[model samples]
Target: MTDEPRLSAQDMIERLGPVLSRRTRIRAVTALLAGVAGAVFVGTLWWSEPGPLPGRTHLAFALFTMFCLTWAGYGGWLVTRRVALFATDRVIAAWIGLAASLATTAVIIVVAVQRGTSVGLALVVGGLFVAVALVLAVRAHARRAALLRRMHELSGREER
Candidate 1:
């Protein structure tokens, strides 16, 4: 008797469904999200009030938020089209890291400006954010490299 185990129909469907879904519609979904984020960013810029301490902070936060949303959406769109499921984990991790860094930096800058924080203190805070971001980005890059190596090994085996 053959040693290969047979997969049931449900098992096959479960295995293949995600591959098919990723190949078919991931790019479209990312694009739609990008468009929506861009629209919201614009809307916030056009409509948010601008006349107080909190308003100033809000505006600064909004700018950073816009950058985060646009970058994530656009990057997701690009990565999905090219990498499919290969490097998505790396990309998402990097995006989260960057968003955290930028948001932290922006908030610090806003608060510093609003409350007249000393330059030394602001610099220290900024440094902390940078350190955290660097760590996260490096981890993500390592993870991606590992994944790429695995894919390369699998492909080489298939050729043999």
Candidate 2:
């Protein structure tokens, strides 16, 4: 083995630069803004209704509000956390995001159809979400593969 010393945690972190990248920061901000805006809009609408709504309507409003709040909380947690995400973590996160996007799209389309609303608009929005998620997933997988390749190359060199 070579006599080169191993990198310390601080050195490794310095070499990696900022763990919370610009893209991640932007994503967290977007999620927070969207979630808070959605929650506020739904809450206001529910509160300002003229007449007494059905139990099912109230339940729906509550569920939607909670969902928005949950997303906001997740965003807030991500923003506050200082942990660095590894390649495997990124891959898992990307998959989770893809699943969530697909589920959300399905729900939107189903709701639009059930309500006799403009299914076209719903489909367009859902398509956009799915496309974005797919792109992110692909990028994540590529990044992981590149990292793994680099790791193997470095290890091979160390052995020699």
Candidate 3:
């Protein structure tokens, strides 16, 4: 007979809840910090520029904070499930990077067109975000290859 004790589904879930919650505390705190930092960064930038355009920046920051919180929640869920995170995380990171790049780029373009300004710091920052997104794409591709190799090994299949 196996030495393990049998547990009902409900019992298993109930027991796991506290354990998962403990495991997720660090992730939750990190996400919260990131969200606050992002908001503060945006707010500071807006404060420096005394103009009506700051409203748009505030809106953008709000969107960013919402995205960060949602991403954090997803990460916590992943931890709670005790899933291997590397493969899944890369795709999510790439998606987030792409979204940030696109959103920032759009904001820069719209602001430039509307305000007839050039060489602003936001434009430079947006360019940097694009570069970061490119890096994320490359990293995600590498992680995917690694994941496939691991799966092949686990399945006792020879890799081509």
Residues 74-147, model 2: lDDT tens digits: 67766776765545545655666677677667677767777888889878888888888889889888998997
lDDT of each: 0.63, 0.74, 0.65
Count of clashes in candidate 1:
0
Off by over 4 Å in 1: 1-46, 50-62, 71-83, 92-96, 99-116
Reference-based lDDT, residue 79, model 3 = 54
Candidate 3 regions exceeding 4 Å error are 1-29, 36-58, 119-124, 157-160
Q: Over all chains combined, what TM-score does candidate 3 have?
A: 0.58
In Å, residue 98's CA in model 1 sits off its true spot by: 2.7
Clashes by residue pair, model 1: none
How well is each residue in 1-160 modelled by candidate 3, as lDDT tens digits? 9998665434444565453455455654565567556656655665676657666777676667666665566555545555434356556657776886878688777877779777467777888888888888888889888976765564453222
Off by over 4 Å in 2: 1-4, 8-16, 54-67, 87-100, 115-121, 148-160
Q: Global lDDT for candidate 2? A: 0.74
Per-residue alpha-carbon lDDT of candidate 1 for residues 1-160, written as tens digits (9 for 90 to 100)? 8998765434443475454355336654565576567657766765675665466656765665666566556655654553235555546656665775776676777677768776577668777877877787788777778876876775566556
TM-score, structure 2 vs. true: 0.59
Q: List the pairs of residues colliding in candidate 3.
A: none
Ranking by lDDT: 2, 3, 1
Q: What TM-score fits each model?
A: 0.52, 0.59, 0.58
Candidate 1 at 70: error in angstroms? Answer: 1.9
